[model samples]
Each structure stands twice: as C-alpha cells, then as structure tokens.
Target: MIQRRLPIASASLLGLAAALSACASGNDLPSADTAASQVTTIGVNSYLWRASLEAVSFAPLLQADSAGGVIVTDWFANPENPAERVKLTVSILDQDLRADALRVAASRQVSQGGGWVDAPVQAATVQKLEDIILTKARELRRQAIAS
Candidate 1:
C-alpha cells in the first residue's frame, strides 16, 4: 500500500509543476516595439528628458528634477553678444515622445546702463528650440531600437 501511494503522490506533483510552468510564460509583458516608446522609469519619458538636457547643455543648470520633469537653466550670455543674456525653462508634460508633450519657455535680458532689463522672447526662437529637442529625442529612441 505504501508503494502505491508514493506513485500517486509523484504523479500529482508532476501535474502541479506543469500547470505552474504554463502560467509563468510571459505573455502579459510589453513587446519590444512598444516598450521603447512608453518608457517611464523616471516618472517621465527617459528619451525626452535626456534630449532636453543635451539641448541646453551650453547653459548652467539652475534646477533639474527628474520626477517633476522640469529643467531650468541659468542665464547664458553669448560670448559674441555680451550685452544680451537668455535663460531657459524646459518642461516635459507627458511620458510619451509626442510633439505636444514638451514645452519651452525663454527669458531674455539686455544689458542697459550696467543693469539688466527684461526683453521679449521671440516666438520663432522658442518654437525652434522645441523642434530641436523633439528631433533629438526621436533620434535617441531610434538609436535605442537599433541597438
């Protein structure tokens, strides 16, 4: 009777193991194609965040928060144009790499009488910056896929 019971228990254990293996298959995981575009490991899209940093690397960073998705740059004055200075604020609005997910704001100042005075930022200038950042982000994503 003991020998018979041992064989029955072994069969039961084998059946349970097979069922568990079937459940562990990884069908629910995201596909490689979609995974790159939807990456949010750092609260916002990683590609966009990196591209924004690269685009404004010329200026000193005043504040950078990954979780908040905001990057602020200190005043940067061109060497050729010492009389004018500009500051930049870049915000990542969403976790996707879409055109509408990014916002760029600029503050301009002109040296007047040895003091700085606020000046209007050109709309075209802001638009161009946004375009650059978006293009860089896309390129980064493509590189990620190629690798």
Candidate 2:
C-alpha cells in the first residue's frame, strides 16, 4: 500500500510545485519589458518606496539605464524611526539608471550593517521604479553633498 501511495503522492507534489513555480517565477506578468529603459531619475521617492515594499515582499526585479545622477533605496521603517528598523528594497541602478546584473541590487544595500530589521521590500516594481527615481535623486544628492 505504501508503494502504491508513493506514485500518487509524488504526482500530487509535482503538480503543486508546478503551480507554485508559475506564480513565483512571475511567468504571468503582462510583459517582462516595461518602461524601464526610459526611466530618468529626478528625485528620490524614498517614502513611497518604503510604503510599497512594506505591503508586499516581491520577487527580484530589474531596470536599464538612467539620465540622472543618484539612485535611491526604498525600505520600510518603524514609525518610531523610519530609517531605524527598515526593510530596504535596494537597487543597483547607477546614476545612469542601469541595472543589468540581477544580483548586484541584492549585494549593495543600505542594510549592510547589522540590525533587527528585516530586508524591507516591495514587489519588484518598487525596485524598477527606484531606478527611475534614483537617476535624478543621485544627481541631486551628489550636488547637495558637494555643496
């Protein structure tokens, strides 16, 4: 009886895995391509980014190049200290707004230091949008820092 159950159990497990993969892999996206290439950073949307991610922990996302200077990292924070226990949805978008390497975004983050905060995140869209916002934010930040 156990031997016979193995095949049925295996089949059930396989089906469940397939269904999950489809959803988790983002295969059902409307388009893998979006307005990513044209994103230009004007300013940082840090607050919005944080809010978006607090609601949804998303899969990995990406972007291309930008025409601005600085990039932004969005992370959710505890109301007490917004930046304290924050979960950052980091982006590897350069001042140029390009995010080619998928892993690069994860490697670089505002959360490098130890903390009790989880890696704050939103859907991949938060990351994609950050590239757009950061191109400009980076430039502004650079200019401000220089001043």
| TM-score of each model, paired residue for residue | 0.78, 0.21
Residue 94 lDDT, candidate 2, scale 0-100: 29
Where model 1 places Cα greater than 4 Å from the true spot, the runs are 1-31
For model 1, what is the error of residue 52's alpha carbon versus the real structure, in angstroms, after optimal superposition?
0.2
* Per-model root-mean-square deviation over C-alphas: 9.6, 18.8
lDDT of 1 by residue, 91-110 (tens): 99999999999999999999
> Which residue runs of candidate 2 sit more than 4 Å off their true CA positions?
1-76, 80-84, 89-120, 134-147
> For candidate 1, what's the RMSD?
9.6
